[model samples]
Target chain A: MKLSIIGVGLIGGSIALKLKEKKIVDFVCGIDNSQDNLNEALALNIIDEKADLEDGIKNSDVIIIAIPVDATRKILPKVLDLMSDSQTVMDVGSTKAGIVESVKNHARRSRFVAFHPMWGTENNGPKSAIAESFSGKAGVICNREESAQDAIKMVETIVESLDMHTIFMNAEAHDLHTAYISHISHITSYALANTVLEKEKEEDTIFQLASSGFSSTVRLAKSHPEMWVPIFKQNKENVLDVLNEHISQLKKFKSALEKENFEYLGELIENANKIRGILDK
Target chain B: MKLSIIGVGLIGGSIALKLKEKKIVDFVCGIDNSQDNLNEALALNIIDEKADLEDGIKNSDVIIIAIPVDATRKILPKVLDLMSDSQTVMDVGSTKAGIVESVKNHARRSRFVAFHPMWGTENNGPKSAIAESFSGKAGVICNREESAQDAIKMVETIVESLDMHTIFMNAEAHDLHTAYISHISHITSYALANTVLEKEKEEDTIFQLASSGFSSTVRLAKSHPEMWVPIFKQNKENVLDVLNEHISQLKKFKSALEKENFEYLGELIENANKIRGILDK
Candidate 1:
């Protein structure tokens, strides 16, 4: 099978490399706006051929849209317009509602699958891609019924080849759940980083006294704004809902401390400990 | 030298194991309110012998107090009361101001050192003790001027034996800095966990969609409240100060999202990205 990975960045390059490693896809055409990224992907052997959008879309049997959500919304219609009925198109965007709605009325809508592989790191670009990045993670396919059976099968095959389990859900539900599980975490990390940066004037002290816990909590602050901004923009209402809940949750902690209510503080922490059951680690 | 580790759980057991491994202390007497912990420590070779608090303090030349901050504040003066002029006592509490102030006017105040090893995990108990847990981490000694020269030297030597670099600062400043870098991170983590648990009622969905980013941010929520509540109580004012700053920072993100101010959101994230330069990873 031949695959075309648009954007040729972290997630795109990772999926391409994993499919090639599994010998499920023989050729990968890299399509990216940045020539430097294309060269880096090609030099790193993340793709077999670097092609322009037209060539990349026409030559491959499967096309994956792996870019910022805003960019994906703008280009999905164009990507669908250029694809033949036999070719399959899938997205790896963090937000699914806007992308699915963008091409809902297109003639080739049946060829596009709204898919999101639930895996990423603070790093980016082709250099950060790993063949094992998606292994054991969830591959969420939203609005699966909207796509043709052949397109769904193709995307599922790619997800399986990458060693991820499949999860089917509606586009709206996916956005809502992701806002809670994924998007709010990023906001907390960024705000936490900004908090330390705002309160702690001594950079050397922060660098020296930073424990493993501090680093782990703030690690997601290093994620790219270009990618995350679009996600917050597209999922604005849901993200705002969770953000409000998160702030109110923080206020409870503040109130506990101000009141010196040790009993209430302990209860709050014990309740948060309930997450241990939900998270594997 | 003979050593005593009061409250032989995670931090205390870890110190005993490492000192024994490095041959810095020949004997370790474990003291704890829980007999089961002492037995587990002895079974794991984390301690050589189990002793009551009186015997543990009187027999050893050095005493290391590692317990909840509230417990440490209550027991530190008594431990110092049992020690001779040649003996030294040090604490491994997260907050320094309260612990140091607890015994400020004691006759043997100079023999007690305020020390904190900047390393920990969500897990606890003797089973969680590792000899190398403090390696490459900071060992902070607050109010060095208040500690006797010999006591300071002994704690510094133990820090070196544990393969950690020593940092010296005043007690008040240490509490302030830790509130920004460490205490606030825990609050943010617990709050983030509670937000998700409160909002996302579907546990299975969270388990499936929890990304590496989400897990990293909320990992500290698994920390034992027995340990954290006291730290927050001791450093309540500083923690509250930073927590307020953190809430305002988060409100900025919320406002930006609500108003669709992508530029401000981008700036917030870019500012947060500065932390990448501070953290080694």
Candidate 2:
């Protein structure tokens, strides 16, 4: 099989490497607008060749869109228009509702499968790609019923070959749950980084006194803004909903602390501890 | 030198192990309110023997109080009252201002050193202790002027021997900085955990789509309430001030998302990205 991957950054580069390593793709070609990214991906053996999107779509059996969420919405329909019934196209963007809706009425809608692999790091770019990036993580497949059976089966086979568990959900449900579980985390981290950076003027003291818990909580603040800004925009409503609730929760905690209500603070923390049960599952 | 560690739980037990492993102390004894914790500490070889507070204070050359903040405030005065000029006493608690103020005018204040080691995990109790736990972390020695010169020297040597850098700060400065850097992180995490748990009812969905970012942001929510409650209460004013700023930051992000002001959101994230400089330092 031959594959064409768009973006050619962290997720795209990692997918290309994993496909070649597993012998699932005989040749993998990449399409990226950035010359530096294309050159780096080629130097790292992330792709067999680089080609334009038109040539990539015409030649490969599969085309994977791994760009930002807004870019995915713009380019997915174009790819769907160019795709044949025998070819498959999939997107690995974080938000699914917009892209899925934009392509729903297209002639070749059945050829597209929307997927989100629930794995990433604070780092980005082709150099950040790892060969075993997706192992042991869950890959969400949104609106599978709209896609062709063969396309769904092939996507499942590819994801499973990379050692990922697949879960199915509608685009609306996927966006809502992802806003709660994933997007809010990024917002909280960014706010936390900003809060600490605002007050702790002495950078040396922050570096010296930072504990593992602080590091862990603020790790996502290092994520690329180009990629995340589009995600926050595409899923604006759900993200805003969760963000409002999150702020309210923080206000309650502040009030409790101001009142010196240790018992209430303890109860809140204990209730939050129930997250262990959900995560441990 | 013989050492006695009060409150034979996570922090105290870990310190005992490191002292024993480095052969800095000829014998290690433990004193805990809970007999089970004492037995567990002994079983794990965190200490060689168990003793009451008075016995431990009188017989040992050095006494380490590693307990919750409230307990530390109540116990430090008693320990100082029983101390001799040849013996050094130190308390390892998260909040420094309250503990320091509680013993400020005590006659034996010169024999006591107030220290806060900036290292810990979400897990607690004796079983959570790890060997060489405080290595490479920063140890904050608060109000050094209140401590005898010899006591300060001895405590500094012990912290340095554990491969840690010692930073000197007054109690007020220490509490303010810790509230901004450490305490606020925990509050945000706990509130975030509760927010997500309240909104996302499908536990299976949360388990499936949750990313490393979510797990890291919520990790501090798993911390024991008993360990954190007193810390919050002790540093209530500083924690509330930082918490208010944090909530205001989140509200700004929420409004930006609500208004679809991508430019403002982008700038907010870009500004937050400046944290990389501090973290990398």
Candidate 3:
């Protein structure tokens, strides 16, 4: 397989490295707007060569879009328009509904697969790519019925080569579930980090006391705004719904504390501990 | 030094293991309300022997209270009443103000040192005790001036033996700082886990989508409420203040999302990212 990856950043670079590691792709072509990123990807040997979109499309068996969701939404239709019958296009965008909807009416829609490999870190760029980035994680394929059987199979093959479990769901359900499980986590982390940063002026103190569960809870706060802002913008309604629920939960905790209702607070924490059964599996 | 550890659970058990590994304690006697925990501690070699609270105190030169904050508040004075001038008492409770105040008027008040080791995990019991648990973490000693120099030196030496950096603050300041840096993190994580569990009915989906980030963000939700509830109850006012601030921050993000104000959301995230400077240090 010849794989062409757009963006050439964390997700794209990771997929390229993983595919090359698995010997699933004979050649990888990177198409990135940032020449510096392309240069870094080349220096890291993440891709065999660099090419423009047209040249990348003409030369590759598969094209993977791994840019921010808003950018992916804008460029997906053009990429779909340029797809050939034998070539398949897949996306690794965090938000699927907007990107899937953007190309819904394209004539070559069946040649495109809407995918979200459920893996990422706060770190970014080609330098942060890992061959095992997607290993043991889920890869969501939204609106699988919309894609042709061959295109779906090709994307599934890629997901399998990356050692990911495949999950098929509608675009709406995909966005909603991710907002509950993934997107809300980032929002909570960011808000928690800002809360500490805002209230606690002692930087050295936070550094010293970070190990007491603060570090992991705030780890996602370091995520790049360039990646997450577009996700929040594209999945506004779903993110808003979850964020509202999260705020209400925080308020419930606050009120319990205010009323000195230790029993109620304990019950809330006990209820929350139920996630252990699900997450530990 | 001889050591007696009350409540041979996660915190207590871990301290015993690390002290034994470092050969800082010639012997560690275990005392807990639960016979099963005491038996497990003995069987796991986390403690040298089992003793009642009175027996443990009489036989050891130093007593370490590693119980929940509420339990610590109730038992601290009793332990202090039994202490000899040559003996010292230290606590590893998450909240300090309540525990410190509980023994403030005791005749042997100067014999007690209030300490909070800035380390923990979701796991519990003797089997979960680890030798390297406190390494590279901060150890806070509250109201250091209240304890005698010998008592303070003994606790600080124990902290150093565990390879932790010592931080000294008054009881009020210790409680307040922990509320911001540690206690609120657990609340956020528990609420986050509960939020996802309440909204997303599909447990299988959460299991499949448990990315490294999601797993870490919700890790503290797996924490036993038995350990956390008393901390929240004891540190009610400070935890409430930080929780309210955290809720307000979450509301800001929610409002931004509801208003489709991507720019504001981006700014919030960028501001949150400033935590990297403090945490990565």
- lDDT tens digits, residue span A1-281, model 2: 99999999999989889988999998888899998999999999998788998889998998999999999999998888877899999999899999999988998999999999998888888999998999999999999999999999999988987789999989999999999999999999999998998888888888889988899999999987899999999899999889888988888788778777778888999999999888978
**For model 3, how does the per-residue alpha-carbon lDDT over B1-281 read when each residue is reduced to its tens digit?**
88999999988998999888888888999999899999999999999899988899999999999888888888998998888999999999888888888887888999999998899999988888888999988899988888999999998889999999998888898888999998999999989988898888999888987788899999999998788888888888888889889998999998888888888999999999999888886
Q: What would the per-residue lDDT of candidate 1 be over residues A169-205, giving only the tens digit for each residue?
A: 9999999999999999999999999999999989999
Error of 1 at B64 (Å): 0.9
Q: Lowest summed lDDT over 10 consecutive residues: which window, candidate 2 chain A?
A: A254-263
Which has the higher DockQ value, candidate number 2 or candidate number 3? 3
- Model 2 C-alpha RMSD to native: 1.3
Per-residue CA lDDT of model 2 for B1-281, tens digit only, reads: 99999988888888888878888887888999899998898889888899998888888999999989999999999998888989999989999999999998999899999998989998888899987889889999999988999999999988986678899999999999999889999999999999998899988888888888799999999988988999998888888888888988888898888888889999889988888878877
Native contacts retained per candidate? 0.95, 0.84, 0.89
Worst 10 residues of 3 chain B by lDDT: B95-104
What local lDDT does model 2 show for residue B176? 92
Candidate lDDT scores, in order, read: 0.94, 0.90, 0.90
Error of 1 at A181 (Å): 0.1
Pairs in clash, predicted candidate 2: none
lDDT of 3 by residue, A79-127 (tens): 8888788999999988888888888888899999999998999999999
- CAPRI classification of candidate 1: high
- Can you give the lDDT of residue A139 in candidate 2? 93
